[model samples]
Target: MLKHTGRRQQILVALVAFLVSALATVLASTVTTASPSVQPGSDGKSGSPGATSTKPSAPSSLSDPRKPLPIGLAYGDTLTWKNDQELAVGLGDAVDSGAKWIRVDLSWNDIQPDSPKTYEWQRFDRVLNGARARGLEVLATIGYTPKWARKAGCSTDDACPPADPAKFAAFARDAAKRYASQGVHMWEVWNEPNIPFWAPKPDPAGYTELLTATSKALRQADPQAYVLMGGLAAVGTDPSIAYVSQGDFLTAVCKLGGNKVVDAISYHPYTYPYLPSAKTSFGTAMEDISSAQGNLVSILAGNGTPDLPIWITETGAPTNGPGTATDGKTIPPDTTHVTEAYQAAIATDTVQAAAANPHVGAVFWFSDQDTGQAADKQHRSMFYGLRHFDGTPKPALAALKAAILAYEHSR
Candidate 1:
């Protein structure tokens, strides 16, 4: 998931960078391993409690009026910003791309940058309302501690955990309460907490505490919401650099009862240099999601949350780099970089693979459109859109749309 080396530079501009997204709310005090229960409000008309084993089949027409999509068919996009017009155009484009869901940041710093009591709801509200108007479901990733929320003289990246997690829980409750009625039920705690995104260092226990508090606070505000643990970035253990393998980080959290408190596990299983279908010796990417015996599914099962659902909150491949081959598109490379053709292949493989696996509740491609001529430091490449920066649609987007339509209707 660490596709860009300049991520630190990117973080300077993204006050609400990737939220580790540990989330929760009206979840039953004790969750069942196989299918977690959601409140009636969360399910909308379905009014079902637990997640359905088989997702509702997709409508015949991709562009037809999209009913609330089933989780299994929950194809989505991770968006960086939600300006007024972009929602209508960008999100509208998402729908055209066969995406029914959007995972967007609800930065705590942006909302309450002034003080604990001060709040600004106008901009965030536009996202919720806009998505609702377009019938696109939203998963709000809430995190990013404000300057005041961090300890004094704390000069770490915005990934710093709040000095008072309780304060963040309050902000989460307020945000959840304010948007629940406006049609936002999915909440992710933070983004990639298992990496440098957690700041000073990645602390599963600290993140667990924050998720627990935020989950409890959300329960009070909106009993109908479904909370997800922050999306764990796929990485190996490297204490020398303050990194913990996703397996170790999650195992530690599950030991602390993190698995028992939430409805589903959020993960970012980004398979780039290799396509999702590639058989690699290295145990990373899609293998972390399902292929390997030690993937998220088995990990949660062994740790006590057996058959728990996994929402692939972020996954995609970069379209350009030194790795690019002639003919303008490269195949998978030896490094984590891949060409547009291969990236398009990933877009197809990811959707088809998720459809074949029931444990995957959702898969949101890392972007909706491109931001740079090619992914680089300035654009925060990780969240680049599926299209070219020039506004020309990439093969990845079309591939994703066709794959979704095929998977959904076939079901």
Candidate 2:
């Protein structure tokens, strides 16, 4: 009878153990089926099959934060006007003033006037060799369509776009090949294409086509070449004068995929008659050029190119130094005139502002020295140089040097 009771008790304990195990298995199955494995960025959300996560990563910047912002000089026609001795003096001043780059006009017309096969690179060769000798990098502005390459009715207009994009591309390839060995890696596609002064009329699509052709040719010639978009003139919207606002022009160009070809966007953010920090009627401030830069960043980001750099390729105030008005009257000196003192102060402030902005890769003072052309007198472009036409140093030269040095040291 005791053996029978022991067997019965053992059976009862086994039954309880089996029941518990079954309950645990059922619970485990329930939990396993209820919970789904989620991948990173999924956050337990459902998506279409093969769809990527909607979360966007941080946008990248084109400006290399690792490198110091280079200070450059926009001595446009200076190279063409100055002899070897004069060129040396100008470049010497640039180097002494802490400028690492000098922008010179590489006129397409001058290079190949008659035919694409006919090349006259003597002037450019001298200028480029001179610049390299002085340890100054060149940002060659290669544009101004030759008469033979201009479109119909645009024969005399150097500002006209090439009749054929291939012609421009050929020119770009030749120039890049010729100068690639001289450390001339940076090229500004053209001057201000956003105005009639550069293009017959601002056509973003045409500009993009030209830029793409030129850029591809350049990269093919020199794998390390950087193609910067033409510096957009900082002019107000005046369609009557064929002037598109800088913001509008940039937006249009960027939308048309200009960012795809160009490594950087260049602008002449001149707040002439006002400080760089002053606000324009268009609700943007010139002092903090970053505001305009930010607009460009947004445009590029929207176009899936968030990493393009912004170059202030031209920015400086022009002084009214010994110039008469076109009306045959003495131009009265006013406080508005970019005097020596004001130019110095402005130069210091402009560089300081640009250096502080991470988007700004370079700041090019409009000119190294003033020009003597009578036509320049009618426009402010004639007097935006750091030195007078005679090569005497303007107060802005010392100020710019000090500003660049201080900024570099601080960095």
Candidate 3:
């Protein structure tokens, strides 16, 4: 995802420049991948023990609520980070192009690097404020265990509670309390907790416990704020692997009394090379997620939480593969590398899918711009953003604008 050269860098400079802006919690114990044997809470409600349901005002129309924009978040720990200014511009672009919401990750580890007393709100203030200023709601992800809160042998991004469960819970409570004040309401407890991305060995039971605890903290902080279950990564391709299949993870959670714990289910359906439909081959990038979604819904229904919605909180298709083409051209997909058309079509499709799916409440495209994380930064790779590596918009940019116009007109 690295930028090619000076010309490329300048082309994407606007996105990077605006980013000079903006900027989670937890608990712990012996984290094992064990499963609870009892049936899940199917009492038609969700809350910590002895807590009662306090439903928020329902949507104007449940029939076909305008889905949230399938967009991206400005993630941290990367070289090409996004600042508040860049985020504002990116969100403005998305809003102008018909996006209803924007996803922003509020890393628990980074925010509470030490203790709840050492909370950091400056970074997030910029991002949340910027997006809101442009009329975009936030789908905030609140997770990432800091080194201090993790257990022993937790070497990588994935691992258990940094130190203890109480500390994690404190962090979670503080996050809910603070964000609630900021008006950046929707909250996702963690990111793919069922996978190694959060925990090395798919610890479904342990994650359920984490979700339950975090959900309690959030509900206490702000009854009005929406709390979504973390999206599970697609793990259906192999049963024997250590990863937890998103479907199976849901099933396990349902069994562990997790049905009434959160408001909705979130997911990361990273279908690469974009399949035209979910019925594509198993190997097809997003096909597995499409398939997993089917199974997950069934699991939810069986647990009697069928009314809960699904949010493709994160989803996108890379536009940079050699075999890739938008409407059928072999050109590159970024501003510098290719025309704006490819990027626009990809953005349009992301919007189209989000709008079409009735079950999906939101769809935040994976990013605002590429941060040059690795090699092979395709014209439309993750490193490939709406604008070129420099500050120019590719075909995708303009295409997205047209699609947004059509979307608004449809209303």
Highest-lDDT candidate: 2
Per-candidate Cα lDDT values, in order, are 0.69, 0.74, 0.60
lDDT of 2 by residue, 1-411 (tens): 999999999999999999999999999999999775532222321211121222111111223365677788887856776787898888887898898888889999888888877998997988888878878878889889988899888777889999898889888999989888777778889899989956678888888788878877887787666678899887777989999877788788777767766667787887644556545555433533356544665766777656566788888877754432221122345433555677787788888877767777678888788775435555666777788777788898999999989988886
How well is each residue in 1-411 modelled by candidate 3, as lDDT tens digits? 454677688868866665543210111122222322212222337454423333433211222364233334423233114665665566665665556666666777667666656867776777777766776666677777877678778845534554565566667677778877667557787777667666556666777777787777766777665677887776563545567677778888889977678777887776544432334434432443334445666677889777666777665545444545454223235322322354455567666665665555555665545545336644444554555455455565566667666756666
lDDT of 2: 0.74
TM-score of 3: 0.74
- Candidate 2 residues lying further than 4 Å off, grouped into runs, are 1-62, 278-289, 292-294, 321-336, 373-378
Residue 392 lDDT in candidate 2:
85
- Model 1, residue 57: distance off in Å is 14
lDDT of 1 by residue, 1-411 (tens): 565757866886564443322223223333555455432223322212332222223311211223323322222323335456655766766677788877888888778877887887876777667767877778888988888888556645567899889999999999988997886767889988998788878998999989888877876777666778998888888988888878888898888878766767788887666566666666547777667766776778888666566778888766566545322134434443555776788788888766556666677877766656643723346434676666677777788888888877874
* Candidate 1: segments with Cα more than 4 A from true spot: 1-83, 325-336, 374-383
For candidate 2, the clash count comes to 3
What lDDT does candidate 2 reach at residue 266? 86
Model 1 per-residue lDDT at 116: 82
